[model samples]
Target: MTPAPAGRDPDARASLPLLLDAVLGVGSEPELQATLQHIVDSATELCAARYGALGVVDPERVRLTGLYTAGMTEAERAALPELPDGRTGLPGALISDPRPLMPQDLSKDSRAAGLPPGHPLMRSYLGVPIRVHTEVFGHLHLAGKEGGGPFTDQDLALLRVLASQAGTAIGNARLYETARRRERWIEGAAAVTTTLLAGRPAADALMCVAERARLLADAAAGVVLQPTPEGGMEIVAASTHGDPGDLVGTTIAPGSAVLGQLLGGEPVFIEDSATDPRMTTPVRERFGPSMMLPLQSGGRLIGTLALPRPRGGRPYDAVDRLLASQFASQAALALVLADAQHDREQLAVYEDRDRIARDLHDLVVQRLFATEMMLESTKKRAAAAPAGDTVGEDTVGEDLARAVDELDSTIQEVRTAIFALQQPPSDAPTTFRGRVLRETGGAAVLLGFQPSVQFTGAVDTLLPEPVAGDLLAALRAALAAAHRRSEVTSIEVAVDATPARVRLTVTDDGRTTSGTRGTTRTWESAL
Candidate 1:
């Protein structure tokens, strides 16, 4: 069609070539928001309109998401009750069927009558949809001619060309953004796999997953929940920016839809956990979007990895869900591999311990027993010697008896060491209180019943090693003395370590009525 006469557009038509050049060049703006804003500004300048707004449509085509306005003061825009929902008014027509229109008067249009209370007055209107390829992304709406006349045909034609270029710029910006986001997610998944394979503890492996996933997804919190014996799931590890004492130990019951799916090794995605009927946990109320992925590999279900965003945070897009799911799979494989490595290392340790235990029993115990036998024979010979030599023989016998006692004690200790070495590594004691429990538990085999042991304060951390060793010796002596008594029934041991001192009291019902034979032993040491 022919353009409007020079009499109408006059000076405005002269700048149309430069305007097209500028609009087409906005694709290199690099930033998505800036590129979009520049497009709106270019449209207003090219059309010579007093007010301009670029309404961004939501992905679902439900409503306008954001407004990029030009030629309006910040205060004026802020005073408005709410931004325009472009899909509801005159602009909605463009979204339904994108096309250019320059209405003679908007006040006569019924759809433009329901303006918010603080809206500005306008008459002439021009609008066009900004399409990204085939999708109607949104519309550029302008009103009221700048020079106080109608929008000529030349002005409408100019906007259509600018709209085409704006679409290209917007599309390129989005592609760039998606690429950068995907890069971060890929790197994050790789980091988690590397960490899990580094032979850390099982707990640490889970924690590495939680921390990395939280950062990658930009969620409020990340948690790894392991199945409990009760057919439910309990949070074993949690990663949060602040205090996480409450996140750990949270449980998802057996019957919830989300929990059931996760337990069965299926993934769950919720747009709004706070309102989703399938989410039954109270923690869901604090989150909007969420993803629950099962960590399974080789037909074994490890657990569920959950990432939850804050109550109003943006929902995850298709790309986000896909990347996160793939990350979860890689993480699960890493966890299984890490667990196997740990088991192998532990097996090697146990084998070495068994060899050491055998050497102690076979060599050390035999030698000590042989030496004790020789001492016993020498003592027998001394006791039988004649009266003139009685003095020397008695002295010789006394020395031999003490040596025999020492050898017997050494043999008993070696036997206990062998028993300890033969037990699983988990059974080993890393704390003083644990060692004391080990001692009492061993004594139960001979006592025919278990002893009740009670601890108060931080005995394991606060008690010194030497003082603890002395207490153990006293406890052994008392228990051994009680075992020799007639009809010993029960034993109770208590260790109370305060800031001032550590005290141990061993009381037994087996204490004989003859006080000289058995007694309650109390051992105390100053801190």
Candidate 2:
């Protein structure tokens, strides 16, 4: 085999259509694995090679991390020897130099002396380094052009251009992976929020989050550790393919394993869980690698999320950690908000019950007092009447007695009204004024008169629980005060609410004459 002529124009348009179709055609698609396979196929066809592969470089291990091939049976491709590290073979050499390679004959070349044992079907080879900026990312290798012919200079130029485009595609794929991971995290977070708000138990909510985490991260298992009463940790939830009973309900002492780091409000990464010094039990051997992140809210450590990778899998990368941590934080916040909303609802119920109790007491007591007054007045008038004209006295006594009986019946009717008022509202009213009216109607019987009420300006559209309670209490007080005045004829109540403030006024046409009025007491004293 002879070296191809070197003076061919580097910018030749012969392979431009193929290059454009390969790079720009499927670059932004969501399916990353399929897109990568397309790149390998296009590279092989552009170079007219019988076999081709794109090998992803692993910096840490200094070897091929992943490999995709075209024009080979599955068994044949699987049997290919592994490419080693440190510039040993053609692929490694091209990667290290970050340039193109055009080897005419591999068997006759001294530089290819230590090729891996049992390497198959290679007499001529050509490759180009895929690069991002100045750093070499990987390499694209073509083995033996068709018809046993040497590769032309034009072939190397085309491969180089394709390699450049391939690098951009690889970068785009990585970015797409990141974005997809982020989208999954967001969906998981939303699910956690829904479960928590639906009033699922804390343990159940945590389990839901763990299950989603395992699926999103492609991990073997997931666990949630919550701080215990003894300043330790309790494994409240665990999601895994195997039996989770061993992990669930387990307790970890403070400063024990990765759970401790999480309890201390810091995230921990165990690239090799079996070898880490913190592993205190044989359980760590079950997983080869793992990542643990703290679930925190408002600077407080609420719990931890622990995820374990499958056996023979690489450790979690930066993107995985970022996504996991974000999900953990959202889960924590959801738990907190759910608890807070529940507490607020409970408090509102308590307040409403108390107001109902007070209103019933006021109405019942006032009616009973009026009944007692009517009975006493009748009794005194009957005793003082003369005994002459027995028939006339008897008629007078009968009339007085009938009036007392009627008053007693009215008092019983008022007691029934009070009983109805003692109960809370069954459903939420549509508007704030409607709620206010419902509340005021319950207390109206206590005032002994139907008070005229008017609403001016925009009444409150929706009253917050606190403001509603306050307004109900104030309205009752004002109505009671108006009823006590002898000159009071009509009463009017108004509520004016704006975005900035709420104001209420209660006015009555009532006066205290100099001689007929009793000594006055303040409204606060009555309350």
Candidate 3:
């Protein structure tokens, strides 16, 4: 027998305007979720079911994307651990088959065994597939008709109508959400480029990308990793809503399965970071649902951009993956261009410094030398006529000597300044090793011999700033003291920054004014 029209039955006619309003009123909802909730409520009321739910399957089509339910209290929803994802058994039949289904007495259905432990015992079911265009998006499952009777054909008919309209509303909502996400990511990319090209330092440029990406992706932490010279990856920059120390400087050792792919400019997705075999870093234990996207431009891999959410966080969907990857590519290109700009700016600075050095040597030093020569000549003449002259020849000689000493000191200072200007701005001593080497190299000229320098352990990476400053100052003092001693022919400098302490030893084979032998000075500081 055929089902009667909902409009013909007196009771169904009363609900006709409501059902039609639920369909036509969909356009009134500016937010897709509100419209969907309204549809679910209308379906439950029309069919006289205790519960109604719309399950949206993920694009992978393997599981439920999300579940929106009606007729359940907040307490009931909260007691559940997480939403179901196609493990609903018989009701899932509609999901797989994309057809209308109405079943009573679920215990008899073997497939109902997959139902969750705490799910309310549901009986007398009605379900219909929600489709978008030709594709099945998900299914709507309604259960437990009120008034104690089996659901008639009329209830199934009304549910189908709502399911049909639900498909259209859900599709529009998804499109709007995707567009918003794309807008955010694109804006993030533009922001990154703008901030990087504004002449910030290299480290700051990387951080800008991290901060913006973390906000856009709503991740717990955003980290930027670069391939190390030691055939590994190092976290060079990170942005976090909490403490960043743990996230920064984390390393992925060589021979890592994940690093290999990342270095090759491929993206890696992790469902659960704490358990994923490919994630070997210690930080992985704190996060889940991670995306590691390579930042590459012009066939050169700059680094990997990783955004990981806290444990049990929502998984990244297809749109998230795509937009984040695109952002990474754009960020990489901006980084490359920013670095080039920095190099060009440095070149200009170097050229200006070189010109200044030339001017100092050609004009200032030459003039100072000429004055010294004139002063020396006057001193010599004064000394030659000293014995017979009544004029204060002693005073004249002392004045000329003092003038020559001052001029020599001035020239030495000017020469030192010019030497300083010669070193490239980029090569300035920023690390402990570089600073130590610079000090020794600068002293070599005064000693007329290069100092033999040796290092033990990671001096550059392990040495702290305060100790490094103290050590460098002492080294300069020792070198200057050595220059004053007579017969200084050789010098040696050693810096051993061990795990527990930093030790510095300097030895010079130079005799003091007293006929003493070589001298050795040692300094130590706890790390």
Candidate 4:
């Protein structure tokens, strides 16, 4: 196309370059907020107006929820009693119709509601709605024409061009921002899963989820609540900039409206927790917009994850809700997998204990018992030697008796160990016989092997409390004495209980201080 003569269309020649520059200026900013502000600034400059603002429309409420302005000083803004909500005057008219508004004089326009108190005055008005695809994103307002003249049709046309380009720039910025936000949430979920599966304790794992979610959601607090036996939900973990003690342990009662939904595994989103009738917890008044998401995996409800912002904080949008729910689902699955791994680890430990017990019983105990029998036969033969044979022979017989007693003690110690290894690691034995076995089991660690244990005639039933206490005390003293002996090799513990009496016999093949080998100590008490 041939260009029009500059001399004939001087206004067009001057305005076309300014319009192109303004379009490039608005699209240059990649950030959403920066892009919006730049559009407002460019429009005010292009229209030669002293003031300009962009009012963002909330589709749900059909109201201006946010405002970005240019050419207004900080002091001037601070002096104003309140900002406009785009619900009255020309701004409201523009929003209702989504069409351009250009009045020759604002005072003559019926839609004018007059300037707000302490706000700058003088008005040659121009307003235009900005569109992104098919939706009206917001409207741009310009007032106080710089040359003290009313905005002309030429100025309005220039602004329309700028607004159209601004829409495309805003759309691209929004898409970029959404992609970045989704990336952050995904990374947070992956971090939580890695931490949970790293063998963190259950409490720590719950806390990790809360902390990570709070950071990603930009919430004031993050909390995890588990179902109680009473069918209520109690906060078990909390993450917040402030002390979380107040949040932890807060409960939603069984009959509470929110609790019912949470227990049923449904998510609850509250516009303002402080004012929501469904919120009944004492701590609810401290929060504003909140999301309570159910943490569940395969129909098993693990808990609830709650992210609550401070009162009057920004409300979560549709994108925020969608990302958070996805995080919750992933976190729940990780929790279940971690729990299963922990159970498998415990089973492996138990199996190892069983193997050790079997080895002691089937191999060590049998060999020790056979040795004890062989020693007993040797002692008997030596005792039958002639008394007049020699002093050396007498010494040999005494040593043989000690050897036989030591073998018997060694066999008993191995048996005690086998029994101890068979008991559950977490459960403490309550019965008196079990308690006696426990004591001997403890001594085995220091003794390098288990001590022998024998329970005669219903020891757990027949032994009285007082008798059992005293017998245990005497048994401890005897074991200590045996441990003190340098040559101590084995200990035999025998607990005999009857209807009338109980006797605890402790014998060790340890040499006494007086050089005598084989020591026997007995504690007797009446039932």
Candidate 5:
């Protein structure tokens, strides 16, 4: 290749071939770090600077992220002070302002005041804002021009053009990084869900989710909240190795602290928990950055997930929030599913018990009724027999009558046993009116007296489940009360069903010493 012409147009000199080569050179970057390094190197060479630094801006564009750098030894770079977060220095100001800044002497600039302990080699500097459209992505600073002079307008323009290219590359790299992170999070969430759904109990599943969240987010601690019976949150599980035994079992009231905010279905972010106004307890003193995200299932708030970092750690950003929130959502769903499974199991047990009760009632009650009829027939025969065929025959008749009495007592014992067996289980079905009535009968027997229940109209067929359940419960209560009184002789239960409603009446004929001796309690419920 022949020597290039001297004093060529600077724009033309740095354009086309050089830019295309630089862009194409980064195509082989297999990872995000490699891609970022390639871009920084390209930026340095394109601007012809002795030193170059590229800092990725945070989501709010108020902080610099240490990702990649070029043209400095490890020790030299380590010796340099940390870069300012916001639009503090000339470089950050340019990035924030999204404009080219060509400072003749950066060391003397007013904005360069209060430099931290040991800053890198910098003098005449040209800073360009790396931006994609209107959004500023980061800052690119070219320090100490090798030719020894202040950066000219042409240099500023050239840097801006090169910055544009860097912006595109940086944007692509960031996008790639974001997508990879998202993929990893998605896979992690799926794994956690599988682990949770594999019959893990609620506490264990919550702990797994916390561990996975801490690992994925690289957080110092992770906590999971579950709603308690009192509408508060209990920290059921947590990963707090950095400060173990600190946050576990902590009860946070609903809407009281950061955790409460999350449980109330709002995400809470505290850049510094130690100083945040929302932090109400002394426990926050150990943590700096923290995020609380709600865990919900079927639109119902299950609890919260609180992820916190150490006091000196960097603040959490949008990416952290997104990842943590997604994890919380998965954990919420798992918790809800586990709870539902438990409920279903309990219901099944109740159903089984109810079935057994029904079987006993059907088999035992029929036998007792038959026995009662036999006793009635025997009593009739004993009365109908002649006064006395003989004195010895009278003795025989007395023995027969005693035998019938014994049989009657045995029938009463069987009835009592059947009543004891018919008690309703805790989770018994609330729908079936017949089932309810049978349970009411058992309850009545315990109080005393076998209530004579008569269904006047199709009571069971007309009433809805809720109404029927309530009516039956009320009737059972009324009958129990009547049997409790010593004066009550007989209980008569009547259920009347109409098109619009069902009415239940429980009456007892008991002798009141001073008044008309009858007590009636009636309940009417809509279908």
Candidate 6:
């Protein structure tokens, strides 16, 4: 070590290298939390103090929002009932003044707020405000000099320099974190858009958005709520750590204070959902800080995207609110585009189906009917021939008659295929004919061939919803029974509507216990 001149302080010279090392170490950490803790530890070591803490001030500077401590063992920390909020006593004074503080004997200092139970005793104290570009970031406090003496002017000076370096490090760390957070959100939004545009159902799209937002926001749960017919919002999709079944279907009634804001496409930020009077849902008690952002694009309000944390969780900052709101807007636009694409696809399918149906009715059915008529004519001619004119004239007439019947059945099958092609492909069938086809179509998967379906009278107009439902249930049961039977080759279903009643008849060609070739079941219901 170089010798100090007669008038210079040798202690300052001795601590110079340690101060430089502390400054280099603090700024090197990229993470904000790690940087803060490192600064506290370095400051405590440089000042030869027994305890040190760094309390970060909130944006408003009215209270301490975060605390990092060093020199406290895990057992010592666990023994304390709670950490201080730094809103009172010497810590508060430093935040307010933004100046260095040193007190000889904290027990005698009037500004001292006595420690909580199980806290270590302290006498000397030193505090300094860390500033970043003229704005106070936090305060660093050191207590109990190592040699049982009060903190000196040299220690205060050294602590102040270290605090200045910590400010710069904290700023760098915050910027890095903010940039990383933004990138994650952007990537998440892009992923959601890709999934939606790739063609997902409406329910699946909503759930995708919820899951992505929950992950990006680090929330305990994410949910999407849409307006119901009763002028309220209902949760249709939810993504959570646990089972989300209970959260789905939860509603915000029309008169809720928060409902108005959500419906109007306004964002609502709550510090604590459990205690907020505006939150009326029964599930609110499970969450703490919450953000309800309207998923809207252009002039249409789609729904609300809610991200909520569990109780006692960290509240969201300004950056979080901004990023999340932007994400919601993007997700809404994607949903609209996906819905439009789905409609276009459906229309295309309908056009193709109509063309095929037209071909069957115009060409295929016409040909089959013409063949049946020619066969009938031949059978008649065969019958009219003299008894000795041909070797097998009776056999010829019978063969011609059977050919005509087969042609007639072929024509009916073509017409049924045309009808099946004409119905909408994706939605649940509402009309009687459509529903019957749906039942028969489903059975085909298990039966290995489609059942022949025939409808007599205006079934759709005559049958009530109740009757139709019962008929569908009966048809399902018949199909199931047919599937269970051995040697089943075919199934025939018919629905007849009369002025006073409707009937469903299901017949299957399967060997019965008595070795019968067929079985028939009929269900009748009054109008």
Model 5 regions lying over 4 Å from their true place? 1-19, 59-61, 152-158, 227-232, 241-243, 253-260, 356-527
Each model's C-alpha lDDT? 0.80, 0.71, 0.81, 0.85, 0.71, 0.87
Cα lDDT of model 4 by residue, 504-527, tens digit: 899999888799989999888877
Order the candidates by lDDT, highest first.
Answer: 6, 4, 3, 1, 2, 5
Find the 10 residues in a row with the least total lDDT in model 1.
Answer: 418-427
In terms of lDDT, model 6 sits at 0.87
TM-score winner, 1 or 2: 1
Residue pairs with clashing backbones, model 6: none
Candidate 1 displacement at residue 210 in angstroms: 2.9
Error of 5 at 516 (Å): 74
The residue-by-residue lDDT of candidate 5 on 80-107, one tens digit each, is 6665555567755765576777778877
* CA shift of 418, model 6, Å: 6.0
Better of 4 and 5 by TM-score: 4
lDDT of 3: 0.81
For candidate 6, the clash count comes to: 0
- Candidate 2 stretches greater than 4 Å from native: 1-30, 58-64, 78-97, 101-121, 147-153, 241-243, 257-260, 280-283, 356-527
Top lDDT prediction, candidate number: 6
How close to the true structure is residue 424 of candidate 6, measured as C-alpha lDDT?
52
Prediction 2 TM-score vs. true: 0.63
Model 4 per-residue lDDT at 397: 69
Error of 6 at 168 (Å): 1.7
